[model samples]
Each structure stands twice: as structure tokens, then as C-alpha cells.
Target chain A: MKVTESDDVISFAGGLPNPISFPIEALKASANHAITENGSRLFQYSSTQGYAPLREYIAAKYQRVHGLDIHADDVFITTGSQQALELLGKVLIDKGDGIVIEEPGYLGAIQAFTLSEPTFYGVTLENDGLNLEELEHALQQPNVKFVYTVPNFQNPTGLTYSKEKRQQICEIMAKYDDVALIEDDPYGELRFQGEPLPYIGAGKLENSILLGSFSKTVTPGMRLGFIITKNKELMQHIETAKQATDLHTNIFSQYVIYDYLANNDYMEHVQKIIALYKNQADAMLNAMEEFFPAHVDYTRPEGGMFIWATMNNGASAVDVFHKAMDQNVAFVPGDPFYTSKTGVNTMRLNYTNATPEVIREGIKRLGSIL
Target chain B: MKVTESDDVISFAGGLPNPISFPIEALKASANHAITENGSRLFQYSSTQGYAPLREYIAAKYQRVHGLDIHADDVFITTGSQQALELLGKVLIDKGDGIVIEEPGYLGAIQAFTLSEPTFYGVTLENDGLNLEELEHALQQPNVKFVYTVPNFQNPTGLTYSKEKRQQICEIMAKYDDVALIEDDPYGELRFQGEPLPYIGAGKLENSILLGSFSKTVTPGMRLGFIITKNKELMQHIETAKQATDLHTNIFSQYVIYDYLANNDYMEHVQKIIALYKNQADAMLNAMEEFFPAHVDYTRPEGGMFIWATMNNGASAVDVFHKAMDQNVAFVPGDPFYTSKTGVNTMRLNYTNATPEVIREGIKRLGSIL
Candidate 1:
């Protein structure tokens, strides 16, 4: 059976967090409170501007945690980070405009920007972040509209940019008069190793849009996230685009999340998730180190979901994927993540959802197939 | 203060249902069931196609209620009818494409379609529906793309097409080989004063897309809606557009609505809303008859939220709106709904949200101002 056939399949394809990790009791309590206390407000057609308390909460969190001085007005709550990408794509990209993306980026971002039919330019990724030279080359393209980057613990790549590299990229972006930067930081808060680096939008880059989400930290299915931009004109355009898209994000979700944030130890909950994922990551890495061929290369991530593995001597990741699936072990082949011509030898493994035993067994099975 | 400043003002401007009529207890019970029975599924990322049971339920409802043979696979669940409109606009309307709309159509539709920057042609609406001559003239324009209409109880006009007119419009559309039709029927289920008429898409035409929603019937904040299209290729395009837009609609909302449909009586609830709105509509009509100037004219709506009122001797609706606001009564002016150069000396009054007493008193106050 194909991956889409059954829910019982030990699938690694979905970018979903462990269901066991959801704060179900907290969510239930919030739901009851929302319906009983603020039922009318919850059911009414709310302002296109999102729930005020939620926006203020997010803005304050961003300022305190990331040292980013964002105001509530600068934040636009979205259905998900997915909708934020779509709205930004709509407002920023004209026909044939160039969108610079990392060679291996999030597939959802690719899908969102594709609707606008913008030309894609792939920036090569290094250990620290996006390759600065390749990024400069892409930005030099005459119609380049914006560069999209997942700076901290990126999907598929599992790499975070160092502080120096982030500042360099920001300087390069500041030098460009026309191009804007979309810094997507959905996985930023999950860091388990080293000091947290500043976001690409942190310091002096004025022409930047930052996307943050509670999906990884809280729950993905709530479909709650937000976009922040310091530039008023760009924010206005995105706000209009949002109104034309879904009228507004789900107000009930906004209120529920706000209530949860207001009444709970959110940081403690996030720390628990981090500990769980960190242990899983370690198990997967240890299994790979023990079982995999010496020539097989992979990145050891500090935090976040994925580990990108590249097979040596041009061994095909697709072949291994098919063989491993027969043993009920599956991983996403890395070719889909890349916009370039070369992507046959790489695949992505996610450690967030599987148990330690499953990770060990699955990696061993994958190694046997390889 | 402006009408937008306070919720306490007598509002006929918002497209909202009566707050008193919401199935709050039922919804709360459904939500509790959803969280308890399927908490993991509710908190996990779901299929982009939507929750299967919800789609199946909607499809069966369409077949049973409207006599349309729709399958679950043919349905694409959306955030709301608003998102459905936005998705259709994204997939179908390329830049500079010609889209025909009724002269006084829904403002949300206009806003949703405007993002594509499509050239719009207005088909003048008569007592029955769209004027055939004007529609034919608009369709004669080279490369006319599609015609959008609300066949049952339109937004501002609250006019239902006669059965003969429906056939005529579909036949005309069939003749134009390249033209498509979008039948947006958000208010179709709320009929209280008229016999049921066949939907324009129910016939032999294979090029029509129909939109339906639970917003008006169930609750708007749930933001549950779906689109039905027989054109498979176009449906695939729309699915892709939906993935790009918001991944999928809220899984919890979908599950809650599905459980509610499964456990409770849907038609009985709809009947209650209809009875409430019907009384409110009658009160507004009665007040208009008693207090409005002799030369003022308005539609006697058979169903839905609105009654289109044209002022005496071509008086500006905006001026009347200002005067009414001064008297603490508010409504949407009609000019924004039109696609043509000519202004409509009209206003749209929604009777759904206000109590019968409030409607009568508000209309009397506006009448004195006029």
C-alpha cells in the first residue's frame, strides 16, 4: 500500500508533531471557558484585525524572547504560517518575479509561492545557513522580488545560521534597495543546543517579514500563526491580501490560544517538548552512527524535526526509500525539497514523532536497505 | 461615533445571523464529543481534501435536499464561503480575464475577485434575475470568461430567479462554448416565503460550479463551507489552490460540524433560523411600508438576510446612509456592489441579526431622518 493508504503506516512524510504531546486537558479547559464565558464574541464575525489580546501577547513574547521590538499593530494573525506565506506571495510577487529560496526548503512554501507563478532561484545551503555567494548571485537577478529563508533549524536541512552569518545576510539585504526578505522562523524556539542566535529580521534590516508559528510549540491543527513586518506599507498590503483571502483567521482558535497562553506555563510545556524531541534526535543520530556506512553524511541538528542525509558515491535516495518502505520504514526523499537539477542522493529523516525504540528500529531497517 | 465604532448600534450592515438563534448548547456538546472521542485526530494535521465524514455528509445533504448527485470526492471544504470565492478567483481568473457579475452583487464576492484584477462586466438585474439582454451583451465581449450569480436570494437584491429564467440563463451559458458559470448559493437554505426553485447548476450544463456554506445555517464563526464542481480538471486546480491557500480548513471545526450533523437534527435547526429571520424580515418590510416616503421602493424578499431599497427620485444612497447613521440606524450603501459606471440609488438592509422590535424601531428612526 502507498503512504496515503492507511493511518497505521509508520509514516515520516508528514510534518506533524506527536499527538501525545498535545495539551489536551488544557485545550479542553480553554474550549469550555471560551464557549461559556465569551460565547457571543467567539461566534460573532470579528474584526479583520485579529483578536487583540492574542496579538498583544504574541508581540510581547517576540520582544522578550527574541529581542525584536514589534508592536501589536505589526502582527497579523493567520490561519497558519501556510496562509502567511500565501498572503505574502500574493502581495509581493508579480508575474515572472524572482523568488530566492534555499535549495532544500519547505515544500509547503514552494506550493504557496508557485500559485503566484514567480520565477524560482535556488540558493545553496552551507552548514551555517544559505550560501552567501549563491544568495548574492540570485539577488543580482533583475526582477528578484524577495529571498525566502528558514534561518533557524530549517525543515529538511536541520541547519541554523550562525549570528555572524545572519548579520552578513542582513547587511547584504540592506544593501539591496528593491528586494525584501521573508524570514520564516517556525522552528526557532525548539533549540536544544548552543545559545539562541538573533533572527535575520532582528537588527537593522527594515525590509523584512517575519513569520512565526505556535504549531511546533503547541499544536499544528489549531492552524494558528502570525506575520510581522516593520514596514507599514508592506503590512497594509498583506492585511488587504488577508481580507481578500479568508476574511480573517479563525477567531475561536485565536481566543483559545490566547486563553491558554494567559493561564498556563507555556514555557514549561515547550521545554518538555524540547526534551522529548532532543532525546529522539539523539537516538536517531546514535543509530545512524552505529549502522550507516562510513561515507554516508548527515547533519546533527541542535533542534527541530529533520536530519538531511546524503549517500556517498551517488547512491540513489529514491531506491533506498522504496526498499525501506517494504520493511514499514519510511522517510521523505530529499529531491522534492530542492528546486535545482541535482537531488538524487539525499533524503530527510524526522525524529520528532517517533519513540526512541521506533527511531532505533526504523534507522536500523533503513540502514539494512541502504 | 461611526457605525463601525460600536456593536450596540442598530446594524443592518453586517452579514450576520441572529445571535439568539445560535445552537450554542448543541455546538458545545458536539465540541466536547469531538475533543473527547477524537482529540488526537482533531489536533493533528488532516487531509487537504477535508474531514471525510463531513464531506460525505455534505454530499449526501446536497443529493437529498437539492436533488443534485454530488459525491464526497467532488467536494472541497473551505474555511468559509468567502474562502471558496477566493479559491475560485485564484484558480479561474487570470489577469485581464473577463468575469460577468450581477450589477448589485455581494460585496464580498467583488472583494474576493478583485485580487486577480479581472475585468468585470455587470449584467443588469431585473425583478426576476439578471436581465437576459444585458447578460447576452456582456457575454458577447471577446474572451468573456465566466458569469457569477446568486440564483436564490441574492445578497443585496434578495431576488430569486424564476424557474424559466434559470433555464434561460443556463441555456445561454451552454451556447457560449467557452464561458463558465459560478452559482454561489450561501442563502439558498434560508427560504421562508417562496417555493423551492432548481439551482442553475442542477441541469445539463457541465461547466457550472456551485458554492454552499453552513455559515448562515449552522454558524458563521465555524467557517465551514464547500464547493461542488462537475468539471474534474477545474476541481483539481481548485484543490491545488486550496493547498496553497490554507493547507486545509480547521480540522476541529470540521469534526465538530460533522458530529453535530450526525447526532442532532440539522433541518429542524435550519427551520428555527428561517422562522426567526422570516419574522424579522416581515417587521422590516412592515415598518418600511408604514414609514418610508411614498416614492421609495424596496424588494419584498422571499428569503435571506437583505431587502434592496431604492430611494425616491434617484437620491444618493450614501447620503441616506449618513442620515440614517445620524439616527442610530446603519446599512450598506449599494454603489460598491455595482461593476458599472452608473450609481445605484439603493441600499441593502439585513433583517437577520436584529430583533423584530429593534428592526421596526430602527427603520422608523431612519424614516424620520430621510
Candidate 2:
């Protein structure tokens, strides 16, 4: 059941960015420059906070992109956004501490935080974002450390929170001083059709932490990300915790990325990626509309990698997964994404890894299977 | 306090392997080859365990170098040995779990395990290794999870356990069903003068876990290390834990290291490092004997980066460190290495990063300051 599908199989399983999207030659040159220019510093122990220039670049980007007041020191570079989740778990969560998450949340975040042994309370998600009423209830719970969400282009589900909801979240969070918000914005730059929404955490910096990653826009293999916050004390705890985690993220990767940023325009590269993903997403959605029965419905994503579908008809996603496999198509069953057990007929399909041709073909096959 | 003491300062603070010790050209070539051959695979998300070939190579090295019957499946590549320490803390430690470390242990390990809030049992470090009586007692203590040690040319101390002691440790560990032994062997390959002692954990198998790294032997910047254990269940747990840590160690670094190992004779490079380090060690020892006051004492290390020094006179190491810094000669105070903060006049010196002439001058200045 875990077998890699054959070459003929049209797989919509991986949320991978297009392989051709990378400017390989530029990256290679940057690596070469890092080795030549930095000399031993590239290979030696570096500051646990991370390379200053890279941190500065990220800081500047955040200010420019989101209108946030992120200083260079406010950023602590991480191995990945996944690690940011783990570090938050390590620094903030104690055994049986209350952690608020969205229903059908990001699985990676769930996996990252579970080791801290927090008791999870999930807020139900609506079409626009997390249900505000449920989220307020979760936040008010005793010992709730933080409420974590991916505000833009969230994983598994392709929903982005509305601007009004973002403001209401900030106002709601201010009511509970003990509760913190974690707004993870990994795919914030990938919006294809809609105007970008203000990050809820961005407006409430004092009570929130922002996580950013280069995995989607750049190369995931470099494994670069950051935790951005206004809280210096929290950053210090994470920096110290990071020392124990891996001393720091790979200095070599840090140098290479710094050089790449200095020499090339990565935002331009991100734009190209956005264009490619938008086309693939359109193809997948169109195919589903044309071929899928009315009983099956999916989220019409404005941007990002995934399409979350729910079957109105009585069909188990697990059973459909096996049937799809037999038809040489694949997707992630969405039950595992929930902090609580639900979403039995739900599935998440990736539209980013494949081309328009492949995505259309895969969605057509999946539609027939459904 | 964090100043990198000027170019004029002959510092002995870092346990850094000489940058010149690495074959930079070979490493670059390997990086090129990895990108050219693997393409998207090098830049894509990889297995949580590691790149399979890299794990296989490490498993093979254990068999060839240490005669440990390690299977590829037994290995899990980490960001570095530091992360290995952190991962061990995550998987094996709970609040108040008993952790046995040396009195003056690796500071990185201390910082890593402290977050787990373990009850530490620090065994006295004899000239040869961990004091056997203390180790045996600690292993028998209730709720002891593991006895962690750097058995060969240990960090900050430069001590290697004897073969007889290794056998004794294995015997003692076997008696405790609940306790495990962790043999951290980052400096094992750099043994310059003494006969290679058997790894206690290697022989103990089921009751032990061994950590190996390319950081000291190759380059720390690439940040590659592995945990080898006969217990597959423990390895599986570590793999899952690692996913939340950083997804996996950088795939590009893994590919480059693998290619370099396949193409180059790294053992020959390590031998060269041993030869250079041994001469520098001799120079540092000789200078101490000639210039240091009679009240001061230091270790005569055979291999690896550090020599442990103790001032018998009631001078504070912190004071000595500041004075030495003013004199443009630097060394690390050994206070931080202690698990329970007893060492106040001990210091750790490194001889590998500088030439013999530099080592002699640095020691002379440090001795005068003391």
C-alpha cells in the first residue's frame, strides 16, 4: 500500500514545488562563492541565532512583504518551519499543557508538537478560516499555551483566513492575556488570485509568533526557516533550545543561501513558482468540475499546493484511497490531519508537484474513482 | 566575553578540527556531482531516517572500522551529533529521569539534556576514563535511563577509556535491564598514539547506542551524524522524533558527504589530522612544562583537539580567563563543563587549530596570566 506508484501512475500525492522552478545554476554559483569567500567560517561553528546577513534579509523581507516590524534580532533561523514547531513545543509546552489547533490542522505541526505531550483542543474550520466562535472557546480554556494556525494557504486545506477574521482574532486574543497565537505562514507568498490578507499574528505581535519557511519558494533541501516574534525573552529561550537541538542549522547551507540572496532576486523566482502552481491548480479544479459527480465536492483554492475535498456520498476516504491506488492515482486521506478523529470522507490532493497535463489527468482519474 | 580574541591572540578555546584538514576541493567536487546526478532528489524532501545510501555507508563503516555488526536499518542520520544528543534526550528522557554524565562532561550534552529536566548523576572522571565505581553505582540507580560518555579523547578532557574499562562497562550495563549506555565517539577516529580501544557500546549492542559524526573528521558545517543501535524499535522512535526536529538533516549535505566518502580515502585524511594534532599537543604540553608555574598542572593528550588543565593554586578560572583575554591569549574556563558546578580552576585548551609555534606562545602567555 505504501509502494511508489509506477511511472504511468498520475500521482497527486506530494505537495512538492516544481523541480524545474529552481534556478540551479544560480544556487550552484552561490555555493561556490560561499566556499571561496567565507573560507573556514563557512565550515566552523557559527552563532546559534544564525548567520546575521541571512537573518537580516529575512527581516527585511518580512517588513516589506507583510508590513511587519521584524528586526534582524527578532528572527531566529531554524532547520525548517517544522523545527520551529518543535522548538515552540520545547520552549512553551509542558506535559498536559493545553494546545489549541484547528480541526483538520497541518499534520506536520501536529507531529512536531505531540512529543511535548500537550493535550490538544481543536477549533472547527469554516470555508473562510477557523470558526471564530469555537476558536474563542478553545483560547479561553485553562492552561491553553497557544492557538496555532497557518493563516495563508494552509496545508491539507486550501483556505486562507479573511481580513475581517484576522482582525477579530487579534481582538479575541487580546482578551485572553495568557494565551498566545502562532501564525505559521509557509505559503503566504503563493497567492494566485486573491488579495493577500494581513496575518492575524502580525497585527498582534506581542501575543503571537510567526513562522516562515524557504522550503516552498526556494529549495527544501537547504532546509531553512525562521521564527519571528517581538518577544526577546521567547527568542532567547528558543536560541538556547536551538543550541541543544543542532547547535545551529547547517552553517554551510546558511552561507549558500546568503550568497544566493545577495546575487539573485529570489522574489522574482517566487513569482515564477506562483505562476506555475496557479496553472496546475486551475487544471486540477477544472478537471474535477467536469468529471466528478455532484456528490463529491472540493475547496476551490485561490492559491497554494492543496485541494481539500469531502465526499457527500457515503464513501470512506481510506477505501477510496485503495481504489484510487488501483486506478494509478494517489492523495492523502485527511483523517490524519485532524487533532480529533473526524474527516472520514475527506482527502487532500496536491496540485503543485505535477504539471497541468499530469494534474488534469490525475484529477480525471480520481474523479472517475470517486 | 564572546570576543574572538584578535589575530594576535593565540587562542586555545575551540575544539575545532583544522580547516586545512579537510579536502575542500574533493568536497566541492562531491557537491557538484550530487547536484548533477541527483538533480531534484538532492533538492527534494527525503526519508525521515536519512538518505539511504549515506546510512548504508555509515553502517558499513561501523562494521569495517569498529567490527560492529550494524545493519543499515539500525542507523538514523541527524543534523549533527549535537542533535543526536537532543534526540536522545527527547526519546529517552522524562522529567526527573536519571542521566549519568561525567563530572566535567561535554557542555553541549549538558545544555541539550537540561531542557528535559533530567536528574543528573555525574561520575568522577579519572585520568583514564569515567571512574568505574561511580559509573557502576550510577547505572544501578533507580530510573537511570542512560550513562552518556565520550569514551575516546573526550571533549574538554582529552581522555580515552582503557580496553579493560570498556569491557567492565559492558558487563555493568548488562546487569541493568532499565539502564542503557550511550558511547559518543566523535573523536575515536583521531586517536594518534594509543591503541584503539573497543567501543563499550559497540560490544554491548542491545543495551547501548553509539553516536558517530563527520563533523570533527570532515567538516562541522555540513552537520552530519548518526545513531547506531541494535534495537530497531528505538531507532524507529528516533526517526519519528527527527521528523519533528528538522524533517531530516539537509539532503544536499547528505548527498555531498556520501559522494565524497565514495570517492576519497577519508581514513588517510584522518591520519594526517592525527599527525598534525599530535605534534601540536606535544608542543602545548612541552610549553606548559617549561613556562607554567609548578602549581599548575595539565594533561599530556595523545590525540584529538583538547588538553584539560588545572591550576592547583586557589585562582579562579574565570579570573584567569579574563586576565588571559587581556593578554591576548584565550582558553575556555572549565566551569561550564561541570554538571554540578564544582570545577572553578580547570580550563580546556585546544591545540589542533594552530601551529606548534602558536601553541607554545599561547600557553606561555596563559601560564603567566595564571
Candidate 3:
């Protein structure tokens, strides 16, 4: 049952980025530089909005890469993207307020939103994106506060929205003035295959909100993430909420990370991580294609950490999980991903935390069980 | 109104710990040591509870200092003590639930609790501690969830509860099974003049919770704080809430702080901070004594960051705030400290962020206005 504890276990259960992907020596130097340069001000209480230089860097990155009109004021730092979910819950959601989420959604989002006790309207996810009809239906609900989407390399499923679907979503959401669009893009920068797609609502939609995280690409242990939006009213409320939650995210981490980004080539560092994860994703996909039974269907992810698999032969994933544990292999059963009680026949496999060889071995074991 | 931004302004408004008190060099060494020793694990995702050694150190400190029966399992790390308040609100509070607070409460607590939309019952603070009668009245409410107190050197007030009052509070709270007792003790270790008093409910009551922070003694920029409780049920709920909030506190900061504590003389460092704060407090108090009008009453604090001043002649603090600004001085108006709309004649002066000469100048200017 606790195969994760065993030294020989090949676990794909974690959502962790590989530690090898972290630029440790560079970060250590950055930490030292930030401490030496900033002096005691780095250790003192700072503005609730966050460190100005870090926010400026984030704004500059988005402006340069996306050609979006994002400014430093548009970005607000958070403890993590997980906290962005919680703060949004605090700021926007009321009890029984309608929240539109992808069916078999990100569990962390679900967990954060659940604290507000919102009425979840989960739309079905298609191969390319969310089901358009279901998205429209969920949006049409009178109390719907926001439509939450992970447009690129989505968690658990590791699926990206098609360009056509992204445009349609923007067009449809533009009609609803009361509703906000939350496009979470933690894995957007990790795209290793195919052309990068533009965000669905970031610039096009008036009420669009974007969530970004350094957890996957840089470091998760620092727990630095941010919310970017042009909506001043909503941002103001979140600032207040952020102040109450933790005053601000860790300023020491903020300074250290800002120094790291400033001194080193950030994109070059990210490219190394992209290459590493690309190899892992390829190994897992190839292993599944070779060894998995025909009745067991799985996603071939382009980027990000996870692969979603469904047993079309009606094999219960819970039973398979037990058998896999017996063989010293582990993965997450996908039931917890859904807002509703579904995904019983599905499971989520993570490729980023393990090596290519370990991922292949783990998938081979799972394929035998299937 | 913007005197705070001016260089010549003597600001007594900030609740920041003095930068001079921070052990920057020692902490820099600790940061380097932690990153070098732990490798990339320090940058990866960690336990929701916290870094184990840090929690263990915290637990052992309480066991050794207070003779409280605490273990590593009893301590849960948070982003900051501010987040502890937020987590408590999430776990223990419901809309319309009864919350007992001080009359001039910690504004951060007020902000955090306000998110849950709880019905706050403010028990008046006497010279020694909370008014026993008012506390009893609040706890007797049917929906009372918790009683929040800053028992040692409270924020804005800088008052410590007497040993007798502590005993009485424990006795009174022991009757309320449903109400949890939250004794936030951030400044407990910073006692410079008085004999340290025992905690009211940490060892005496079943549902007692103690909130501690490194923000005051070590560094606020790192945003590390924790909750220590023997109540497993409440702790489990807080753990879930913490995981949903930010995954965990910054592990890099946690590891570095733990490393610092392990390698350095922590209590010796704390003593230095205590001594620095004591001198600042004495300087402000002495200035106030010499300059303030006879009609104005203010507390002579033995320890902690602030001194509460009340206009006995019924002068409006807001009006005084404007005049003080005209003279390029700043102090916090006390209206926000109350849960209710009161405290118009009171103001909170902070001593830790300014020099003695500056504090004297500020008090002189404020006194002329008074």
C-alpha cells in the first residue's frame, strides 16, 4: 500500500519536478548575491504586492515573449499557484457560487476552490480542449463567477487546447461580462513539441486572468507563483486577501529568484529542463505504445509532467493500483481529479519526477497489470 | 498624508522589526550551508507539515523552555503566523460563528478573521490582561469557535498578561468545550525586563493552540511561522487547509533557518534582539513621558514593539494624524485595530523601526499637536 516508501519502487505518483532540473549552484550564487547586495532590507518586511524587481521581471518576460500589454502592476506575487487558487477563492467565490472547471480537473484547484464551498460546474474535456457545448452550458449558468482552464499541458491529462478551441472560448466568454476567465498556465513554458499556442483569454478577453508558476521550470520549494490580470478591481481584492493570508510570499525567495533570473540566462536554464522532461515524456509514451494492452488507452503528452490513462476494457483502476503496488510501482488513481464521482477506470502517471529508465520500467509494470 | 514617503519624516507607524537586529552575515552563511549540504532537495517540493528538523527544533525549544510536552508531530509550519490566522479561520470558523478577540485586537488577525465573516466578540483589555468578566461573556456565546489572544507583548498594545490573569483565562476557557483557545506568542521570547510568564492554555487546556513566528526574532522576509497544538483533530484540519493554501511554507527558507539554528547560538541572537528592542522601547517611552500632555494617557511597555496611546481629552486621532503629517511625522491611527467602529481617540506608536533621536523628535511633534 505504501510502495512509495520502498527504495526499489518506481513511483510515478508525485507531481514534483525532477530535482536535477533545479539550477542549484546558480541559485546558491543568486542567494548570496541577493543577500550581499540588498543587505538587511532583503530580510525586512516588504510590500504586500511583492518585490518590485521580481514583479518587473515577470512583467517584462510576458511582454517580450507574448507581446502582451502586461505591466508590473498587473502582476501580484503569491506563495504558489496553489495559493493563487485559494486567494481567487477568497476574493471571488461565495458559497454556492458557480465555478466552471474542466471535468477531471486539477486536484489542487479543486481542493483550493472547495474551501469556499462553491458549486462546481465541470465541463467535459475533449482530446484537443474542453468540449465547446459543455463549456457554453457551464458559462450560461447564472451564478458562474469564472471559467477556469489550464490551456497548455494541463495537469493529470497533459492535454493542450487547439488554437481554434482557444479562439472560440475567448469569443464565447467575451459575451459574459459578469464572468472572469482564469487561464492557469503552469506548464505553458514547458512545451517541448509542436508550435506554442497563444493564450485563450489573456489579451483578448476583458476579464481574463492568468496564473503562472516558477515551480515546474525553476523551483517548487521556494513556493513562488503569481497572478496576472488587467482587472484592477479584482486585483485590489486579491491584494487585500494576499496581505491577510501571508502578508506576501517569501521575500527572501523573491529576491534570490530575481537575482537568479537577472544574472543568468533564464530561457537557457528552462531549455535544459525542457530537454530533460522531453526525454522522460517520450520514454513513457513509447513504453505505453509497445507494452500496454489495446484496451488500455493513454495520452501521449507533448510537455508537462503527467499522462492520463483510461481503461476502456472496464478494468477498475483501484484494483490495478493494488496490483501495481504489489509489483513496487505506483501512480495516482484518477477518481480524485473529477469534481464528480467519476474517473474510476482512469489513472494519472507522472513522468517528470522520475528518470526515463524508471518511467519506462514503471509503465511496463502497469501495462502488464492492465 | 504621504509623510511616510518623505525622508525627513519620523514614522512611528510601521510594525517592522529593526533591521539592525537581523543576523544577516550568520543567515547568509546558513543559506549557503543549507543549499550546499542538502543539494537540490532544498529546491524541490517538501512535506505539507514542514522541514522536519525545523519543526523538531521548535518543539524541543518549547519543551526545554516552557516545560510543555510538545513533540515534532505537534508543530505545523506555515507561510507566516499571518497564514496561521487564515488557516485557523478556514478550519474553525463559519460565517456567523462567534469569535472572541481583544478590544484593540491585532489588526492582522482582524483582517484574516474578517475573510470568514465571523461574528467577533471583543473582550475588553485591562491593565493586566483581558477583562475576565467580558471574556466569560464572549465564551458563553452559543456559536463561539475560538478565543484569539496575544498573551505576551501583544501587537499595537505591547501588554503582557499577568500570571494570575493567565490562570483565570485557562480556568474560564476550560468550561467551553467547543471554543478553541489561540494564544499567539510571537514576542514571548523577546522579554527584556520582566520575568517571563507561563502560557495560559498551552499545557492546561485540551484545545489550546499556540502560534509562534520567526518573523519577529529572525526574519519577516522569509515568512516562516508555525502552529503548535496538542489537538490532533484541529491540527489535521489546519494541515489540510495549509496544503490547499500554499502546498507548504518556503522549504529553502525553512532549511536555511533550521541550518542557522543548528549552527548558531539562537537564544544568544534572540537576546541581542531583545536588548535592541528594549532600548528602543525605553527611548520612545521616555520621550513620550517628557513631551506628552497630561491629558494624554499612554502605556509604559516593558517589552515588544508598540505603545498604545489614548487621548483622554477626547481629541480625534485622525485630526492629530493630519497635523502630525504637517510636521513630517507618522503614527498609526487606532480605528482599524477594533473589530467594531470605535477607538477614534487612540493611536498605536511603533518604536522598533526608528532610532531613539528620531522617536524623540516624532513624539515631540505629536505632543505639540496633542
Error of 1 at B138 (Å): 2.6
Query: Considering summed lDDT, which 10 consecutive residues are worst modelled in model 3 chain B?
Result: B1-10
- Candidate that beats the other on TM-score, 2 or 3, i.e. the better one: 3
Estimate, for each residue in B27-73, the C-alpha lDDT of model 2 and write its tens digit.
Answer: 88888888888887887777888989999999888898778888899
- Give the per-residue lDDT digits (tens) of candidate 3, residues B152-212: 8888788889999999989998898668899998888888887998999999899999999
Residue-level lDDT of model 3, residues A318-369, one tens digit each, is 8888899998899899888898885389899988878788888888888888
Considering only chain B, report the TM-score of model 1: 0.97
DockQ of candidate 3? 0.93
Clash-forming residue pairs, model 2: none
CAPRI tier of model 2:
medium
User: Arrange candidates by DockQ, highest first: which order?
Assistant: 3, 1, 2
What is the model-wide C-alpha lDDT for candidate 1?
0.85
B206-316, model 1: which lDDT tens digit per residue?
Answer: 887889998888777767888888789988988888988888898888888898889999889989988988999999999999989887899998899899988778688
State candidate 1's TM-score: 0.97
Candidate with the larger DockQ of 1 and 3 = 3
| Best lDDT among the predictions, by candidate number | 3
DockQ of 2: 0.74
Candidate models: Cα lDDT each: 0.85, 0.86, 0.90
Clashing pairs in 1: none
Comparison by DockQ, 1 against 2, better one? 1
